[model samples]
Target: MSEVVLITGGSSGIGKSIGELLTTKGFKVYGTSRNPEKYKDSLFPILALDVRDLNTIQQTVKTIIEKENRLDVLINNAGAGITGPIEEIPEAEIKANFETNFFGPINVIKSVLPQMRKQRSGLIINITSIAGYMGLPYRGIYSASKGALELITEAFRMELKDFNIKMTNVAPGDFATNIAAGRYHAPILNDSPYQKPYGNTLKLMDAHVDKGSPPNLMAEAIFNIINSKNPKIHYKVGNFMQRFSIVLKRILPDKLYEKLLINHYKL
Candidate 1:
């Protein structure tokens, strides 16, 4: 029997690409979206899901198991981006961003753990961002949310080791996706100190994403990770500069790293 794979935020972007590729490779893929009807013509099955809603997550996973008998992999790709000066961002907006980017995935993970434990084998992949490793000027909230998920994935790896369940955090630098269009922009005051810098930096960030590597690169990385006997705890996917920047942040001095980021974003 083919392995069953579940992917969230699969209506479009990287999630959709991964779903299509996996389906072609013979995996029984089920992709989730807030409104699956919109993707009625998707190559694989698309289920209605809202990661923020625990009831919906539970029901969807239960439906998958009832039909497939097993879920070999769970890909947490559903997330939202919030961009603005950290100090200016509203508390409500920050909470909502975490709701989708961090807690949503956690809810799904918790719901699937029981079945994964019973199977004694499973793979969980969380799609994070390069910003999670290093804070970006205007995208602090987004960085924090994804950073939280990355840390949680690490803890989960250790806790699930005994159950033979594997987890990985895949951080993609940037990809041409609708993420920018859907990103939440925090309200900026005309007199705020960061108004100009925030606007300029945000533009640069969007431009970089416009030129980012295609989603297929990410799909390829995920495909390899799925087939590996033992995948690494973390995988960074993107162009050389983007992936190398992570290493630079690790080896470079704190002040130097800050300077590099400032210059890159023109902040």
Candidate 2:
């Protein structure tokens, strides 16, 4: 029997690419989207999923497990990008981001744990961002979402070790995706005086993403990690900027690192 892999947010971008490649690898790939109609391909099963709803999550998991009879992998790839400063975003928007980006994955992990535990093995891959590690000026809320996710990934990894379940975090720096395409999804932005900083930071991010690496690179990296004998707990891949961020985050003093990031984004 082929391994059953369920990927949320699998209609497009990196999630779509992952589903496509995993199918090629012979996994019984299942992709979920908020609008099942959008995922028209018959190559993989598409399910309706609103990541924010726990009932929907549970039902989806149960449906997949019942039909497939096994759930070998669950990749939490559904995420939203909110480009704004923390103070500027409305309270409701902040809460919403956490609900979707942070709590959404938590719900999935919790729901899948029972089955994974019963099976005695499963791989949970979370698609985080480099923003998860450290602060980025304009993306404070998105970074917060990812930071929370990183912690969840760590806790899950430590606790699930004896269960033979593996939880891996994949953090890719800016990739070519519609995340910045003036999309409708956004948390409320607070009208703080410092909101202008967020505006500048967003412009900077826009410029950088224009030159960001292709999504295929990230998809390929994920493919490799999935096929590894001993997959790592965290995988970081992408352009020189991500490499520099990791290095500077290690070698530079706190103040120096902050200065560098501020200066880089301020331009």
Instruction: Evaluate candidate 2 by giving its C-alpha RMSD to the native, one decimal.
Output: 2.2
Pull out the clashing pairs in model 1.
Answer: none
Model 1, poorest ten-residue lDDT window? 186-195
Model 2, 159-261: lDDT tens digits are 8999999989999888788778733233334666665666676677778777788888877887787777678878887888786797889888999999988
**TM-score against truth, every candidate:** 0.98, 0.93
The lDDT per prediction is 0.93, 0.83
* Per-residue C-alpha lDDT of model 1 across residues 93-179, encoded as one tens digit per residue: 999999999999999999999999999999999999988998888888899999999999999999999999999999998899999
Which 10-residue window of candidate 2 scores lowest in summed lDDT? 182-191
